[model samples]
Target: MQPWFVYRKCSNRSCDMCIYFLVLFASVCLQVQIKREKALDITSEHLIKAMADQMANEGWRELGYVYLSIDDCWTKKQRDPNGRLEPDPDRFPSGIKALADYVHSRGLKLGIYSDMGNYTCGGYPGTTLDTIKTDAETFSSWEVDMLKFDGCYSNDTEKAIGYPKMSSALNATGRQILYSCSWPAYEGGLPPKVNYTQLGNICNMWRNYGDIQDSWASVLDIIKWYAVNQDVLQPTAGPGHWNDPDMLITGDFGLSYEQSKAQLAIWAILAAPLIMSNDLRTISQEAKDLLQNRLLIYINQDSLGIQGRQIMKVDCLGVWKRELVNGQYAIAVINMGDDGLPRPFTTSLGLLNVTQCPVGYKLYDVFDRNYLGLFNSETTFNLKINPSGVVMLFIQPASVVNHMKRHGSYFG
Candidate 1:
């Protein structure tokens, strides 16, 4: 008998037993797959404990996979005689598996790094052009949950096939590990292609752009570019698959609190993955608040998983919007001008045609948690958005508004 047949026999016999068994089996399979893919990437292993602690304290319940992703320089130039990738003893003297266990004990997952070429981006040895299967198995034995596969030294002649080959090797291990393709799209004369569907078929997420630096221009350019091409990637992103725009620059960068908030806000609107990139061990309270802005993060994690798009643009002023699964609207009014003070901006709620009649709409400022009373059929509000900052609001049906008014004390 098949393995599933025995599992079915062990369950209580009911008319729906067979169907329930099949569903249960499928659900288990899917959970295993998703467990492999869920992840957050980190570069500094030194901050592993602190990162895990912060995530837990902030009520981040499902950070199942905490990838200790070694960006570069975490390996030696040669594998050991046993054919396993050797870690830089100076940095990880306790061995990789010990670190993986530490993360696992904290209720997080672990990940590692390798390149497709003979050497890593930091000139360490890569698994590419070598024993790919063996390298994958080594990671599996070490309890790695994710792998960031970079295209650092991969030759142009081999780049196209290298990623898929590594993915196949990882899958062969039957260990259910996530593969992150880090091929910089801008290089190699490639088209403006983010083939998320094809990539998602094998890997969890792929870097669609180059390295994201800690600069406002870097963040702004990436967001603008992604907004224009988001439709092309919509089909590929969902609960299990995502389009990674790279890591969040929230904590220890030179950015001010306002700038960090702006970065987090735009990224959340874009539905970008929230893998943080700063030294979390000593992150400041302001930085932590910026990273854990519940309202903004909720927009990113909305069930709809729809990336926000630019609905309107004036030279230095813009409006971007996304729809939540609960029939609410998330709108952001952005000011790109140089002025430091907040400037007034407005957008028509009717243009969104949110309600069946495009009338009787009530708005709530998501940031301030204050409800703005009813407005005209073509609802508009003068929002004060700081330079490169946003005024985000959620529009709800008038019924919700009435309910809130009737039970104001209850809601409070």
Candidate 2:
């Protein structure tokens, strides 16, 4: 070649050769566009009307899988002799189809429960010995929007057979229903050899943990595990498919107001599905406010499903942060340990690659709706965080750094 095209100026003084590696690298790596999906899991026992009303009022368009889902009581001692799935009339008085229609009328989708084994978790009859096609067709006929498949009585072989069988049946119906695999994460079902990526393609979301109890400790423990395991399951999460973290415990489950806020903040940061498990009809004002925090909800619904991670830890003062796709940063300064003197914590923008060591950025406290003044060479701020409380921030590019020293601070 006579001459090489150079797109970027050479920075090294000793180099004279025209380099095009950066351009070539950029051209080779294609950016994959991903869509994000918001979901809420509700039990059948929850007040369906109230949940629908609240979701509609709060601007939540999608009412994920609405059925106080028949955890175990929605079945008889056994299936019918004709191999048809039976419904407990006592619980579902209007029948499954009528219930689905009612949910649909309220602009919500109905999700039901099933097991791959002979019985469900609550000992109800499952589709183990029955035809998968028929069971799936039944659900479709009932207008079921989602299915939560349990592996309670399923053996290792059944686990392999049950999921695929149900998937094929559901697909055959030509109805779009979200399929959720409820296999515990610690279980031996998921592995690289089993090709979980393919499974993810078939199911909308899969549960990696058991039922999340209603306690701060339980919630924190599950969140911690998800933070550590997110990278491992990243390939299986996106618009249609997500790594489910179970339902939310924010509304009146015996958690303190501070604890509920912490839970909501953490769940939003994790990008977990926003499923409410409490009785929405009788919830308190504080509980409703915690659930209806739109600012935090937006973070969870960000197109990029990048979960936040703990950036720095100062004993009980834990700082977690995430980078949004819009060149913004979401930070959570939390105090999870014992309540001592209010501790001050700072998060550096340098850690998020937004700026180099010699440059700094500006941050806006989204929660408090206040501006944190800029710092030179690094975006650093201090906040007094109490136990089980959090201070959330959104970091943006420094407006003052762009040649105008007159602008005091644009964070507000």
Candidate 3:
């Protein structure tokens, strides 16, 4: 998934303005929503309200707030008279519209979930070919800013028809609602059926993998999938269309502090969406530290829009690298093994994928938040990686870093 970029203010009159416009388009159109998935099975109006407020106030890097998303179980068992879906009255006492107003009051958008089948994955009534348009209208009327269209009880052909149909229906509403399609994942992620180009035209982001549970095993599973399939899948992701490895589970209970940092590093290296899936109000300070890591956030939000890849992996130890927008790189050294103690892992600049950066690179340790002098091509840097842990480095050519210091700025 590693790709290089050459972005600068175009001075040549002969340059194709279309290329710059496409980059700007991806930057604006693709990242239209600030999304956060509600904690699974425990979603409610009060919970969403609290999390939304927290997202706005917490020291979240770059994108300060998020669209509060209700996953499943928010809707009633069936629809109302106008064929519009209804929220569970008890769970959503003020209703979705009123809750939406409250969220908007804080400058946050509200997102709702749905399936393109007879029933939602949570067994709530989902929209079919018959009700998709009406449902889209209903969401717009209620001030929903994002729609996560899932596939559960539908076949592949049904998915191809219904998912895009829903996108069209949403567009017809004359509301700029962000559409997140789950079609590629249902088709096992990209072959003859999953068209990445069309998905980009339709969705702000699409899931092309399994849901991430809160466990080291789940984290490794996703990392492995990306590592094995990045060549085919990485090019498919950019600003507006992302290969979602699912939500960030850092602030949740399943992963240890070290393991949580690993997940964050890998996700940021991949430039994946930063949709949190944990309960913000109840998260620990350690988890919050990982979630709000400034360096990691900068990497994920880089406009370069290139996902990183594992350049080398041996015996569960690996190195992942991504090119930065400012002609630098973000490198991650991962230790996925079950070593009882710190394992010595090492690599050098020459081994990394990109050929632009010559020899010596000034590096910043993302987790430690400190400068690591200078690492040249011949220098074999060694890191004692803990079990299931990662060491993330933001790397830059020494000349560029020195220039930044002279100008009182730092490379991302």
Query: In every candidate, how many clashes are there?
Result: 1, 5, 2
Question: How accurate locally is residue 311 in candidate 1, as Cα lDDT from 0 to 100?
Answer: 77
lDDT (Cα, tens digit) per residue for candidate 2, span 133-238: 7889889999876677878777767776778778778877877666777754436334653456666545555777767888877877776676566566555555
The segments of candidate 3 whose C-alpha lies over 4 angstroms from its true place after superposition are 1-42, 61-63, 353-359, 401-412
Candidate 1 per-residue C-alpha lDDT over 1-412 given as tens digits, one digit per residue, 9 for 90 to 100? 1111110111111111211000000000112133322321222344455555654455343322134444565665688998779775544667778877877786666767787888776677887655788888899888887778888767765666777777777767777666667764534212444345456566555677777887877877777777666666545565445567777776756566666766666666666667776655567877766555545655666656666777777667667788775466778776767767677765566665555534566677655657787764565667788777767776666655464556333122
Pairs with steric clashes in candidate 1: 66-109
TM-score (C-alpha) between model 3 and the true structure: 0.86
Candidate 2 ranges with C-alpha deviation above 4 Å:
1-50, 53-70, 184-195, 339-342, 356-362, 369-377, 397-412
lDDT of 1 at 185: 55
TM-score of each: 0.79, 0.76, 0.86
Highest-scoring model, lDDT? 3
**CA lDDT of every candidate:** 0.61, 0.59, 0.72
Candidate 1 regions with alpha-carbon error over 4 angstroms: 1-46, 57-68, 184-194, 231-236, 339-341, 357-362, 374-377, 398-412
Q: lDDT of model 1 at residue 164?
A: 72
